[model samples]
Target chain A: MSGRPLRTFAVLGFATTHTALAAEQLLRDLGVPVTPIPAPASIGNGLCGIALRLEPGDVERADTLLERAELRVAARGDIEDV
Target chain B: MPASSSPRPVAYLDHGATSWPKPEQVVHAVTRALTDLGGNPGRGAYAMALAASRAIFESRRTCAELLGVPDSSDLIFQPSCTAGCNLMLKGTLKPGDRVVVGSMEHNAVARPLEHLARTGIEVVVVQGDRTGLVDPDDVEREVRAAPTRAVVCQHASNLTGTIQLIGDLADIAHEHGALMLVDGAQGAGHVDVDIGVLGVDAYATSGHKGMLGPQGVGLLYLSPDLDVRTQVEGGTGGGGSESPDMPIERPDRYEAGTANTPGIVGLGAGAAFLIAEGARQHRRETELVYQLIEGISQIEGFRVLGPPAGAPRVPIVSAVHERLEADRIAFALDRTYGIAARAGLHCAPWAHRTIGTVDCGAVRLGVGWGNTSEHIGLALRALREIVTS
Candidate 1:
């Protein structure tokens, strides 16, 4: 469900360290580049204390990539302030 | 072995009471929430408040994933498992409705039912086996004999370490058109609590005990179909502060005040640890439990409660000496050897009664991921010293 932007950052997603590492590998194979960050203390620190940081406009594409790789985003939201 | 030799190093075997020495991440998450995210969740329009609200939602999602609940919104946050049980019991049942509960239920579930009984609800206590395990067929018979509205059972006995068959019991309750309300206080983190597979209607559990979270937070899971009345009413931050009516939303309807943001934040981190390494941690605790139980069994004049050995159970072990009082032995262990343990009725008199220790509550030892053979050896040595002295 699409809603108004909720956060100040572009977009954020929570996942395990294993999943995050695997996602990085798969993204490299698919010629996609993305950087993951340690989730803000307010949100969560995922398993490795990191989450995939996405551009505000890239939320749609990132969702597609995650789906293609069969990895579920535990939580995701735009970091941009509404 | 005198005081000059120095008391043995502390052996904390009271995880069943409240896990100590929590994972570093739990403590860090708590500190981070307190220091950096100092905003009241769902209370204001500022970015700080929204961030706090977002944190809570994320924590709720993590808890839902761990319990295998399909919807995160259905899992409400409460102050403790006791409060969650109260909410479920008071929310779901009405006066004159009948409920069947296992004999070994802790006060979290039993007290609420008792309170409901005073309000005209009919609460029947079904007998558990000598091992403190409830018989599903017997519970089913109770549901069949009467028009039961619900069946309250705990996932595991805190005192006896017996693990109940919740899925089969849920099936029986469903067959009788009754709701299955489970007290997962001792069950959530230790065992496989997939709600779909277990088929329970509602499950409530503590944060600190099994999830390694702080003490102020717990979770309540309600099946999508079930409806429960709210117990408290106040501000819901639902944008209608003028009206006194509670919001009709799921969590907002149940939680009416400022949320436990820091505790829930810690829960998110701790439960994530359990979810990531649950199998490994379970194996660690299991191996430690077997070692602890085996060592305790070797002590003279000591007897562990429940089945002979190798019974399906949690990591808790309870014992009582032939001559010494349970509390006395517990005190001796602490005073003479720096070992920490719990010895009492453990707040579940029925459990002690079911295990034939109503007169003398058993000394309970709960092994956990932090415990090792060295702790067990120290505890056993202390027990030996007490018996000999």
Candidate 2:
């Protein structure tokens, strides 16, 4: 068994930077390890300024939380690096 | 009115125009935002930009709590209440769509509806009572008569200080398949306003009036269910530069262009003040309003407008003297008594017409967070002297 989690990550993009920050706060409060980073140019297609980077394993929980908070996800994709 | 070496003390009572002498916390927040958080929020990912974004988010959250909006992102910042009203009206109503309104609206709501009427939208105005209070039954009748797209009404009258039955109106609007939009310019901080409890679809209010913030910033809350079309379009700082359309998001869909960061920061402080001291402030202002109304009614030629003393109304008391012009009385109050009051139509000619004061207008004494019993007493004495002399 490996002690560390996988290096693969998923990105969550929003229509505005404010919503991304809001999601970061909400997920962080819920104990979901999320990092805010500039949305990858390829993933956002120039739609959002920032995106949330979290382990691919926690993607479902984060999506549920955002949905519960009424925040719409504009773009989502997988990324290899920070 | 040349410059004088020694300035006379002022008793500012024109809060309906916009509150004066903002709280110390509000002033400091504006200065702090200008100095420390000087970044274009939502534009960059750096530390300064992130700090600015945090400040704006905190403000939106505080405003959401105060206004009873469940989602902070649903509240959009606008330049003024008028701008919010324009966005709500023009964005929601289309050609041939009808809206029901009351006669007690400020020019903020009326003028926009007027312009919309020119574009083929039908504006149906229901008459209010002499005190500028609209009967919900009348609103129901109008809404029932036609296929109304929305019911637009002011939560409180600036000219008369009369509070309308918003809950009842909202019910009527809902039953008739119409949306309820409120112009809450005079009611947000002075009265208890919970958009969810009131069941309104939209509310537009000025930050400076009841919220005790600086001018040039306002709030508009849209229900999650309603989707209003975007009115203004520009860089929202959320990217999407290649597309001509605004992003399909909660706030970015509506809030385009750069924001008033300093103004929003100041409003956050103002909202915080209201949350902490609102109850005590409301009680004090209510007492003072009754006193002003009763004392002014005793004057020989003065008759107060709006609800009677001891009735629930905003802290506004407008009076018309039998012999003097309204503007002249306001001038005398300003120069001789150092009491600031508003006169004439108060930017609500339709309201004056409804109250039968269109011919002479009324002198309005609007109380706010800064008024005191001593100030009210001085205003009473000054009015007695002005009327008798």
Candidate 3:
């Protein structure tokens, strides 16, 4: 468990066409880590607008943050440390 | 269809359906089979024909070993899992016989059993839990209700990647004097399957899927004690006779027409690769799956489907946002993010109904041997972005 910092991503559930802008603001206000990585063209995990990078130990805290923001979190997972 | 106007780099994650970017060895074996061993297998005693026959025999032997079946000749190669399933269903069941199948079966097994149902075969569907795990007792109850001729279940669900308890179900089938047929379309190469220990009478598998082979090749394993009659007939090289019927031999009796020699050769090489990789692949895949499940469960309003954490399941996972249609999410993932995943019914409507995903289906991510840790991370990041937007 005490290895490299685990890069994690987070999804904020499905956003309405109208509320999408508000959702982005909400994600930022919640202090969710944002990464500017390009999406791969062949995987189908659930995501909408924002992605977060976190240590593996911080995943539970990230969940709590999203819940406090009233954002519906969808999925989170570790990425290769890049 | 024309090639893409502007090609973009994509990470393939649909290995449970069919592997993309096949290993070089698989391609080379297929090429060599077509160029060097391009003679009818088991038809002639010439050098080329003998080589072709050897290739076919070796492929069967490899498949038998992978499935943990002792007798190599008991394995028969067919065009696909659908054909193998049809042969097993039609050849084994008589009119008025009863069959028990899991609610999570693919169309290959479901459609054939449904077709047989019209012809006097009674089909009973055993329900699975919301996570797609079926209780062995439920299957046992179904079998005990009547004289069940066969019990059909999938080793892993293509939709949810939920692994079934085949050994327990097989024991129940045996106790009730019924044969068990397992659809291993999503199981074979992605996970380790021991047909002998599972006690299944027949195990049908697709080569193009988890096996990482070319299309048009599949395998069907029959237990030594199960007396499954042949449903198809054609020339099988030996036992020359004027009658145009199936041969009395083992594989020849079931394998009708000329074989896909190249595809089978490729399949053999793919199986060899899996063996070389060893069982560590399963551990790696399961680790990825656990990481994925743990990550996704934290997402509010994002209900994950299939088995819970610590469940014995494959790397395949399905989830959907409460407010989004599964297909809509799938289309966006592919079109905007370049993430390839399967959506909709996944060819098992009964499973969808059982899991309450019939209306919008489920967003399915089936990881393969070729997938890397970076690929999983990238997928998760993209999914978060898509859902948030």
lDDT of each: 0.80, 0.89, 0.74
Predicted candidate 2 versus true structure: per-residue lDDT over B83-189, tens digit per residue = 99999888899999999999999999999999999999999999999988999999999999989999999999999999999999999999999999999999998
True lDDT of residue B356, candidate 1:
90
**Of 2 and 3, which scores higher on DockQ?**
2
Q: What's the ranking of the predictions by DockQ, best on top? A: 2, 1, 3
Q: Compose the digit string of candidate 1's lDDT tens values, residues A24-57.
A: 5556567666565544434432222345565566
Question: Which of the two candidates, 1 or 2, achieves a greater lDDT against the reference?
Answer: 2
Better of 1 and 3 by DockQ: 1
Candidate 3: which docking quality band?
incorrect
Q: Order the candidate numbers by TM-score, best to worst.
A: 2, 1, 3
- DockQ of candidate 2, scored on C-alphas against the true complex (2 decimals): 0.50
Give every candidate's TM-score on chain A: 0.63, 0.85, 0.46
Q: Which pairs clash in the backbone of model 1?
A: A7-A79, A7-A80, A8-A79, A9-A79, A45-A49
**Is 1 or 3 the stronger prediction by lDDT?**
1
Best DockQ goes to which candidate? Answer: 2
Could you give the C-alpha RMSD of every candidate to the true structure, in order shown?
A: 8.1, 3.3, 25.2
